[model samples]
Target: MVTSSILVLFLLGLTAAAVLAAASKVLHVKEDPRIAKVEGCFPGANCGGCGYPGCSAAAAAIVKGDAAPEICVAGGAEIAENIAAIMGTEVSFKEPKVAQNICTGGSRANLLFDYEGVEDCRAEALLYGGEKSCGIGCIGMGTCVKVCSFDAIRLNADGLPIVDMNACRSCGKCAEVCPTGAIRVSGMTMDLLHLNKVDDCLAPCMQKCPAQIDVRTYIQQMKQGDMRGALLTMKERNPLPLAVGRLCPAPCETICRRNIADEGVAIHTLHRFVADWEMNSGSRVRLDCNPPSGHRVAVIGGGPAGLSCAYFLRRIGHEPVIFEKRESLGGMMKGIIPEYRLPEKVVEWEIQTILDLGVDVRNGVEFGRDVTLESLEKEGFEAVFMATGAWKVPGLGIENDDAEGVVDAVTFLDEVGESIDALSGKRIVVVGDTNTAMDVARSAARLGADVSALISCIQRKMSANKNEVKRAAELGSDLKFLTEPVRVIAEDGVVKGVEYRELQYDDPKKATGTPKPVEGTETVLDADMVVIATNRLVDVDALKDQNGEPLFEMDKKTGGIKADKTTLQTSIPHVFAGGEAHTGRNIIIQAVADGRRAARAIHHYVTEGEIPEPKNPQLRVIPESILKNMQVVYNIPRIRVPEISVEERRSTFKEEVKGFVEYDEARKEGSRCLRCGLTCYDAEAGAEYAADPDVSRFDESGKE
Candidate 1:
């Protein structure tokens, strides 16, 4: 019976084997031979840096043409070459990347509660946004260090991860494991392009400054005795550092961290000192630019905006030609600004430095009279930048404003430097209470004009620049408040006096009151000339085409070229406007910043045919409440900036603010900086996370 059973089982096994071999022959599929070759070329690390599951998946994708040979980041150039050889294709190279830690606040960061949870960062982050006060800061748990297969990252004494660039394969594993996104893998493009995001760390001074100069870095360079390095750093954002250093009102000083204790650092003076150092040493710092792109751009108006636009355009390999209506560059800066404030030699030097970068200049070339938009297009210019200044004088709301001896402040300042003798022993009455009016009154007094009075429709406190008003008064100009001009009394189309009336406000208690003209207060002030200090408008006629059609759309409110505030692009697709052309009478720093942004926009539009979206779309806003909470222990006093005496300032056109007397003095002032960042200050300023008895610790339930 056993022999019969064994015979049946053997026969069944033979039948089963026969069926399996037949099925295998019918259902078999073939695999690509190149997949194995590609897989063999991989580093076999399976780091997932290629966005695939493993080497086998990456190899299959490469074979199918879904992925490029250079997708294997760990394998690098050698492996990519080998894979390309096997796949019978050329390798497309990509920018190499390295890991960087975005958060610098480690031990200096504030805390919410003591963390006694699990050792892992991922676990600790589950309770109440981690222990650090900054939600986006590093968790200080070394999860990134553990996942780094190449041993490129290690935890420092401050519990922050430090990346070793040499061993880093750009695998992005550390960035992947990081819970708070503090660790990131960035490439060359990411480093060069600065776009603010919600998670970005920014200092208060950086956010306030229109140019966004790296205040902390430049001051640190100054402290380290790197005067040249500091100037170069300033030149990266602001092309006219020397002019800005002397003339900027310094809005950055208002929000400085040192203001919490004593006073803000002398940022403007430091900037001037570094810039003067470069000038005195007779060395100019011009960065290496890209090869010429063979594209020509016409920049109209040789002002701050035009110079800045040309500088950046040249830096990015595009040829820029500047067209100026006046004989010299620096629209208002060279024409209007008194030599006492910003010297002519400094302005000349600043403009010359920009010209040395291969930028072409055509003086006495008016935009409307000489060259139109169509003429520029016909001249093979790829793009046009309208960086015109606020030259058009607005109406004075008074009759006979067009008469002789009645000149606008812009025209007066422009002609004052060349023809100071024309105003000798003349009676001058300056209207309006703006800083420009004060400048006119002061300049007229200095040039031997018997200034009748400086009149304003607004209250005394409401006038522009109190110090300027006081200076004009000290220079022998009479001050007349709450007065409005009615008409320019002229004989034979020449001014003899200015008719005016005193204004009465409804709310007399408040200084910022609504003014009404008194019924019987008309009066006339005797004068030889009336200098109206009304605001300026853009020359729209200069922006017209040959057919009398507007080349660019006009902004109704601004009475200038309309442009997107962010992109600076006008209605015309190829033409762009910035600085006083769009925004009238802005600071020099703002004009420089606008020029840079407009240049970038133009470059992107010309080259890529589209505007480049910001890499980081949002800027993190640090609350003033939190900023004031910083425990500032240092009581260091602010260093005094050296300046010429008032007597000397009135006599000659020498620069009013003499720069730092010595390098050591400038260095000592630089060291007083708080070195602030986003939620971070100098570590010496007592850490905000110090233990407190009143504060709650980690509860048993692990709740906040």
Candidate 2:
């Protein structure tokens, strides 16, 4: 038994020895001996922070002189020095950088829209660009939070990601995961500056100007020669193209980008050319109304808003009955604008076109007097739109305002339109510094009146468009800046001059309120007639409820209507109000937009019994190339279309500003539009590469 046990033990030991020898010989890895020495000096973190696969690989490269010794960023300066000492190589050092959040704006502090959808930030970004006020701001959708493997980050109450520096190893994973360029690594000394990314491209001149002039559109259009289309486009927005083309303040030119390039485009002259073509060639615009909706609307006042409302209402199959206070249509347009700028015949032609659209005209009918709100209801009208413009002249509150020859600008313009003989040779003093004041000054100067304008604002601070002011100057009118009308001077109830004081702007950047009077700068100017061109006032008593509160009551403080800003509806569900009546005095384009919005609201109210919410109120983005290629031009001198010669202008109230471009010019302006509707595609080829798991991962061979 003893002999058998010994033989078994010897055989077991021999088998174990043979197995160990075979394993070592077959699975041998021949590594350099210096690699062991180099790796011993490392921190042994195995963090894979160095560019190589691992610390072992990094050690091998350093031993072979293939890689620099100071490659491990996580070990930093101390580890780098140790590796360099073992490698027998010297290396320069750099301070490590840390990731930072540059924007101070967070969800709790910055205004943000509620976005409910997919959990992924990429999916949310596809919808309206992630709901931030600024286009380029952080979405704070927690993308960085999810990508952090070390659990080193937490989203604050404000939805902003806060990084815990202690847990952070500078892995750079959060920066790669952020969809927006919100996360960035920088030196400790770096100071971040916030950037504004709101799109201000479609503001002021581009959107607010009447005639939908697409001042940019026509500049590019006229540069190309699609004159007929350009003319048609102009007529689409303004029915009285010839009149607006001739006398609009050209607000677009005042804010023209080309003004920085030396001069502004001649937008008004191009408009005049197209308008004259359509009018002279007997190419009248025809209307196509839908089948009757069995709804009838009553529009009070025949001014721009009223006419525009009537035109649109008729197009949508509703019958519009316009009630004008005067014997003719075109309320303010007919009563206030001089014939030298807008001829009665042009107004007649435009009104005739609206009438052709089946609009019922009830001339010589005044609202609140000849007609009442109850009367319209009794007449079977489904809706009533009150556009009675602020025709009442505002009081200056100065003494002797009731004296003779102290006329309101509206009344003076009305007399000029009527060709009254009283304004032939009188010396006129026009007050205020708006487009209306400029119009009055130019009209009075052309009428042989020695005109002088008294503006409370400085010459450089005039609110009127620069072109209009220049035109007034060219007409030989005297302009007195920083002048305030204290009182009207008179002798025996007859006007003699204006008692005034010079004023100055205290704050140029925030100079919106009343002016500050200069001490001991009181002055008086000699005048035979005084025309007060102050702002107009609106009376909303007619728009009241049974409780005597405004029926369409808006917030008295903010001046914003109580209804939704997008829908433009009033407090009353069935009624909506817009234009100057709701928004005080605004530009023609804003008034037109208000009318259009109100019409849409009324249509929705009548059909759906509720106001429709806007699908998306954000501006659509087109490709940069599309915007760059869009051809916009300005040809006229940014001045009102030239009127009859200075001599002829003073003689009779003839339409001024003759000479328009040919069909070729109009066509060219039409072709310059980039259309602003094309979609942009992603430009990066590697954008889709990150989505593929196989392509994103590194293989055993270290090749991806």
Candidate 3:
């Protein structure tokens, strides 16, 4: 029996050895001999300094003739020569390139205005060539710093970007990203610096944008019947083109060079036309997200800022769960803007698109109540974004503000937008001179109310947009300027009349000139409803810390959240704030731009583990031609966006701007574009040169 067992064991050992040998022979991969030779000749830094997977992969590719031998900078001339000898090839020595700032002057440069508008360089540029002496000078807005994938640039005290030569990779990313073309890629030596020449007539508007979108490209595309391409070009910079096109205040118009001939080429309208066409044509602009990152982010509020932050986070493969306090999306957009100006369907479409991007929308969930920040953190949320808009209305210091029939402008507008018949046919008095008051008066008039807008400042000094104010007058709404409403007379519990005093302007030239109430010039007007269109404030108490102190605090004086201006982050590292809470009540375009910027800040904070410093922000500059044509008569009636009819609009919560253009109108409007982006390029030089690369090369070769 022992002899038989020994024989079986010996056979088993022999069979196992044969099986091992066969497996080894079948699975063994032939190692590339050239890889080791190339690696040996390399610096062996394994720094991944080259734009490749690793040193081994790069070496293998170099051996296979897939990459240039001179790619490994650390290897230097000696290593390059060695690798070349091994590969049987010669390499040409190339000059090292370093990042350089084209613009020299910084904050010391002269300014045209204070530029107290949006913080974004692009938004500021849209509002009249920015407040710089040189039209192409940097605004110090820091858009490039925000967009840098690597922390290689920073804004100095003079509002100029200081590039870290060691950190810079000469990728030309900063140059491509610079709106003003202020940041250029040149050789480490001074030889290339002399080669860099400035374009004297660069468009200031294009220089201010963060995305560096070629404004002229889309305008040319639109002129060439390539509306689809025009829209696509815009989408390359901003995914929510339609929404921005519809609501953007068009700072670009303020600095348009064509204003010298006529009103700025209705650039916003052209953008809207192409954007709407693309949407209706079923070309949805959806972002391609990375694979699931297994990380989660909780975004509070569904306003533009929160939604924008969530959208960008999802694009980076992070799971963002938006906790909206309201039942629907578009926090202030749905609540504040009337349906006529911005339709529900449009808002719904935008929100749905964001939702479709893998963002988990949890509506009707109030932050701090339904889900606390601490609770979210415990639930595995790596980061949180607080974008709750300023919802509280500022009160007028008048005595009868609390009287019946007295209403806050925001509350009244929200009610009217939600239900038009809430107080229809009632005589309404809107106090204040800003756009909100104008919008309230116009909306009330359309709702069948006898609307009267009273302004403390003179007609010329009113804060409302002149075009919108004129539209209100054309719509039969009474606009009383230089009349300040001081006392509200109440009969029993309801408001009976409003007593106003006339005022005289001290300076007729300024928009907010000094005004003095004229003695013995009091008047009374009968009204059933009085809406105070004063100011909007944020409720920071709702966002409290563990100790019950406000987690995200704002300056008591300015009401701006005490947060990093560049990162949009509050004192709390995980919490970020934006929009009305940071900038107060501003234009929709500015708000949208802020949201987009905040998204970038939040992305870096969560992933890169560092808050990027602000860099030189570009400012928009109005051309002399555009300034010459800024006559009051040059203002053409704004092309109203298409909407449902007034009759249909009043019956339900439908839109009211029923004026869509056909293909012909759209084309004509597109042609009317002054081509704001064109100013950036030397049109004379560009026209002289051919756009086709092959044709230009052929011409050059023939000349040679």
Candidate 4:
């Protein structure tokens, strides 16, 4: 009986082994060879940071050429490059993204009551919203820190998670585990709605602004009807919103990513609207100044740059005394900008608002004449900032150019803008093709002069903004393109006309074409007073040292101050320079940016004894899941806010562009923004489902 049973068991075992062998051959699946090669290069954390199911799934996708190697968000630039290396292709990466903790209110969070409980976030989260006044904040439990496979997160002294970017695999685990949703990705796409601060994000619009203004935030605030909040965000970086709104040639609009499909957002006009709302709504930018630092700084030039420096410095608890040679505090805006374009009331209100922030403005105190750099230092001013603008004309060495009627455009505009009686019946010929020339011509026309502009460059080469040109044309100002003025024609100091020659471009396509004067084409153009609208020279005497040399080293080529481009620091260790005095873009927004930067550098130098390395704007990548149908949010066409009619513009300079944007209009216009920043995630929901996600839904987001 035992022998028979053993033989039967052995035969059954052999039959079973044969059946299993057949099943193995039938059930096997073949994977591509490249999948293994691709998997070999992965970071191997299997965090699903690349929006994949796992390392194996991500590897398979790469081999099938379904996604770029940069799909991994946690590994940043390195992982992207390595995956690209496996495919034998050059690395193409997207913006760098890292998880960031949003709430700094860890220790500051107020508690309803204190009670002992489990140390896990999920446990605390269920007990009366995690014991904090801010209901939607980090719960301070280490559930996320405990489960981190790469050990990238830790609690700071304040009980908030500190993300170590270098080690994080962006597996979305920590965000998934956080109970109160305090931690989030910084640059989530527009569709990825955030729990708080849904508007503020690092985007190309913010990066492109020289002011680095949080544009999307303010726009979002505007959409939500938070006018005060919108204005507050603008004031964080730029002190003057009303002035910039009316006068800035917003380069921010040019780089808007939405311009790829259609017209760019009217960002400057939106600024005007927001500022006007703040002004009309009786709201002031509210901020607490730092406690007095007991340091006095001297600032020269009271324009946007100087005022901006003073404003920021004062905000940080330092005292800044601004010196202006003019009787009033307006810089370029007051000095030259016409009342029609920038109302006198606007400049006065903007500058006065800054001055109200505990700044000292000493009018008629010249930099070099009344107050020397050495004297300022001797007077207990620890640092000096020079923003004396390019206010005078450099010698052009042209024949008969020294006549009394020959004026630099800046000074001419200043005088004409203040009192038009002298230029009221004068036949004015402004020389040059740059925006400066157009400004001179327009201001002269507003003053009742018959204005004409002489340009050495051809029609297409005119440097004035097209809007300015159109307005000037409508105002009956004549534009003489490709006509070069060779000399001022005058019998005495009083100007009568200008001698000119036609110019021919050697290459029409060249950006800076070689212009040759057409010989025998010289002719005398009639005029009453000739204004040379050229790049104004910095007033060297205005910034002279006691020895009569320039206070700062001068750039021989541009004849501007030699200051470090990034730091704005001059050769003198204690001095810094910016605005038109330094060689840089002279637009109003750019000057504002310089002022803010210099103020930051000066604050650090005074407080920390060293200038901090300039930090690039922190960026975050847009997930492909959100990008695939981004059009749903970004598909709205850009709205062109109606402007004051050409008839009204020509009739009076009473603020040419329309300032009003109704609530409905603002919503439509602002909606066109691409909001190129990251959105927050429902990581708690994500992680709960992470372990055993519904397969069909899991395949859609690729979130393991």
In terms of lDDT, which candidate is strongest? 1
Per-residue CA lDDT of model 3 for 34-148, tens digit only, reads 8899888876656455667577988988988888788774557678788888888997655566677755556644566787876767777776667776666677888767765
Ranking by TM-score: 1, 4, 3, 2
Cα lDDT of model 4 by residue, 571-679, tens digit:
9978999988886337788888888878877877776788766444233222221322212212344556677776666557687776655877776677666544432
TM-scores for every predicted model: 0.79, 0.61, 0.67, 0.68
Ranking by lDDT: 1, 4, 3, 2
User: Which lDDT tens digits does candidate 1 get at residues 1-704?
Assistant: 99999999999999999999999999887899999989999889988888999999999999888999999878778889998889888976466789988776787777778988777888898766789877788889899998987889999998989999998989899988888889999864344334455566557777778887878778888888887778877877788888998878788887887776667888988888888887888878656565678889999989999999898888767899999998999988896987766788889988988888899999999888899888899998988899888877776877888888888888788777686545667889887777788778878877767885545555355445665777777777887888888999999999988888888678767745567888898998887888888566777777777788887788888787999876788898888999989887677898998888888888888778888766654433456413755456444456787766656655555666687889877876786676775777773532232243322222333222
Candidate maximizing TM-score: 1
lDDT of 3 at 599: 65
Segments in model 4 whose C-alpha atoms lie over 4 Å from true places: 1-201, 417-419, 422-425, 615-635, 678-704
* Alpha carbon deviation, residue 488, candidate 1 (Å): 2.6
Give lDDT per model, in order. Answer: 0.79, 0.63, 0.67, 0.73
Score residue 465 of candidate 2 by CA lDDT: 69
Runs off by more than 4 Å, candidate 2: 1-240, 250-268, 417-419, 422-425, 507-513, 541-564, 618-652, 665-704
